[model samples]
Target: MRKKLPLGVSLFAMLLLLSSQAFAAPQSELWPTWDNSNESNSATFDHSQWQHLLDRYLTEEGQHTLFNYGAVSSQDKAVLEQYLTDLTSLDPRNYRQSEQFAYWVNLYNALTVKVILDEYPIKSITKLGGFLSFGPWDDKATTVAGQSLTLNDIEHRILRPIWNDSRIHYAVNCASLGCPNLAKTAFTAENTESLLDAAATQFTNSEKGASVDGNTLTLSSIYEWYGVDFGDNEQAILKQIDVYRDGKPLKGWSGKIQYDYDWSLNKP
Candidate 1:
């Protein structure tokens, strides 16, 4: 004979399991269509409109880069819509790999901003979804080359699988306070490399990304959620972080590792 758990205890355990599963990191499955990029093409996509919007709304306060979402003028909103329209109008497969990378990153970021602006005054991006849903990540946000895409699809399926670069995590913003800062300038083929390095360096050095107190190390939930992307283990993850930390490599704070994140909207 086996002992059964009390009803209340069983229910609590079930809820805990469900919550953990809900927030688990998505796998990087390739969307094969996106893998088709021309290597020799020299064409460049113009991201000036997005750059203008970023320059106008993104402001840095201490360690955080917040967007002035409430300050966006109706005219500027129109400009944003036009920028997205222009981006989606073309086929990224026709461009070079560098151009495609920049295009996808810019589109992903602009769509996230538009989602927040569409539902302004919310406390967090997670509120955009139903009780069981995890934000609007799975909801169709836009279309490109006749294919519909969600934030999740763009990130996990397209960007992550295509590049297989952990730095991709630093480039995509989710409009949340705990996410990597949204760049003040738009991504372009010419500047994507430097931008990725800068973003990684800025975030890894910030307390929000990783901090040490006594013998404990506290890190952003990004590493917890997407551990496989970094290295799938504590030692490998620490090595990735050390590559970006400002000064000498992190040392001694190996006692306890904790991960946390804030879900508040990244807005001023």
Candidate 2:
């Protein structure tokens, strides 16, 4: 007799097919030419193995998951914190090109979650204070492979030019409901396409992001912070938003965006 199909066999089959086609070879396999010989990348991650690890840790529930950190459904965020600690202990030199890429992406995200958990009830991320104050984001003093790192360092130092992909903005969610929703999975060089697409879609859809009503154009403060990354000027960012509008009709759009960084630990 033939083996019976599972209850949701059809859906599972569809997903498996998609995953098979969608999943690309790990970064190490793809970019054998990359030469980061030293341990500039974190040791715990294997650029070759990190994609799956991130997706798992990101989706993992209970212990390292944030499903039950403050309560509702699970401890997914809690799980994330533990993983952050675990990642910090890993040897960066152990990972190659892609593994290091995935590790930094995961590190940035995990740190963001940690920030919100510490100040769960705050209205905005800015409340943590500024450069001198050690706001919630600043307080993120985790040891990655024995080195203390901050969110700023991760972005400004590691992830930025190393990958040299500005699209990274979408991947790193700020935890504001207005900001892109933290992806349910971690970002790896292999699955980067999916993550970047998700980030762009989320940023476009969020009200805090660029939206239009008739001839008026409204945009999120993100456009302001990394405007240079988007384009040479405001017009450059506006032009990008125009494409995402899906025929929303462009006109004399102009407005000032008030920045509201989300610090509410991306729970749930």
Candidate 3:
């Protein structure tokens, strides 16, 4: 004969098993580090030049309005290209973690702008890909550290995986209105921490970040797609959002969460 446990006992045992399983899971690695200074004694890599260009072109709104593509001058284009070349030449392994973070972010943003310039006059970035694809994020757009790399490589493989910070979602602009504002000032090693925190705060306060209406909570598809990057579950994501929620965060927000994304080019 067989004996059955009480329903309460079965539930308690199940929860205990689940709890142990969760505790056994390995934690993600902390940010990568290098045994070198945060400075470049070789060549001064100031992104202030890029900041100047961004200031000249970007208009402040919830979305940073980029000027008409055709209006971009040859001189500006040359400067951007030179910056990319200089950045690619540097060995990030020689820089401090903060410097490396800034370098990668700047490289990603600059490359994104270059992609838009190379294929200008498009309605959406998604249209600039193969007939069956939406965009060219996977294409090897440049070489770094003697290896060819793509936009996906910089974002997914390196930045997101290595750093494991969700604030990055607010730093890398995809040239779309749905993305976080393309910062007016360039990211510098000196200002990386403050800038990252500011970016997170700004995005969460914006409508594109999180919107609540009664019982429904709407979030950007960025949160949904990259949920793991944010945290373990919805509550974790909400906790991150609450940290930067503007005005008043919704109370007792045990509501359904939905996602939306706009792929339109963020042009003036």
Candidate 4:
């Protein structure tokens, strides 16, 4: 006959296990975790880990499987599966927004990349005959965090809602040639505020972005694309830039220039 365990002993063992897990802080410093340089809030990033993550998820041809719309090749899907496995262990609270934002943004973008990679060589994202055929991409299909998250969900639901700041437009790389370059490293929560500020300043400083050279200000099309993101009016938008920018006086000139969007999907 088998002996029954005492209730008290079983309870004690369970409590011990739970307590140890509670005490074990998640590993914050590990593969693919962002570490802030902590120098200037403006320049706080350590990309060594992020670069590795990018190499792992992004295909050798500089593409991804999931975010690929309908063109995900078998090779791409294999890599994406590996990435998802690694990501399952991630705990966002372990790092700062700068650190985690990159993770989330990249995750979103990578997933989209995988979608497109599945149907590699497609002329457009809409050829697959789903909500993608419609204008609003948010209707497209995806699942994250047990919720059906569309591309719009990542941008509108998770990213915009959490940050509540427009400057993110500059930092959250959309994997489009027109989108800002993906930061070489991930942004850390500790550095998020400063990083966002820097992104605004960097874009405004660029003559290509928004600047005046002898009364001729050649501005990037980003301003035109999401004008409402800045403010109701163009001048209002420029005023915000004025608050952050230095060097050549911006108070004097204001006018229109050509609008441009980089059409090439951001590839290696």
Model 3: per-residue lDDT, tens digit, 109-128? 88988899998988888777
Per-residue lDDT of candidate 2, residues 1-268 (tens digit): 9898877996789767754543221121122222254546444353323333345434433311222225412455546555766777775545666667667777776677567666666555555644334344435457655556667666655666567665677777555544555566666656777777766765675565665555455666566666666677666666776655545533234554344343344445
Question: Which 10-residue window of candidate 4 scores lowest in summed lDDT?
Answer: 25-34
Can you write out model 1's per-residue Cα lDDT over 30-147, one digit (the tens) per residue? 9998899888888899999999999899999888999999999999999999999999999999999899999999999999999999989889998896666778998999999999
Q: How do these models rank on lDDT, best leading?
A: 1, 3, 2, 4
Q: Can you rank all candidates by TM-score, best first? A: 1, 3, 2, 4
Highest TM-score, which number? 1
Q: Cα RMSD (Å) between model 3 and the true structure?
A: 10.5
Window of ten residues with lowest summed lDDT in model 2: 23-32
* Model 1 ranges off by over 4 Å: 1-18, 251-253
Question: How many residue pairs collide in each prediction?
Answer: 0, 26, 0, 34
lDDT of the structure predicted as candidate 3: 0.76
Residue 80 alpha-carbon offset, candidate 4, angstroms: 3.8
Error of 2 at 154 (Å): 0.6
After superposition of all CA atoms, the RMSD between model 1 and the true structure is 2.4
After superposition on all C-alphas, the RMSD of every candidate to the true structure, in Å, is 2.4, 19.4, 10.5, 18.3
Per-residue error (Å), model 2, residue 21: 47
Better candidate by lDDT, 2 or 4:
2
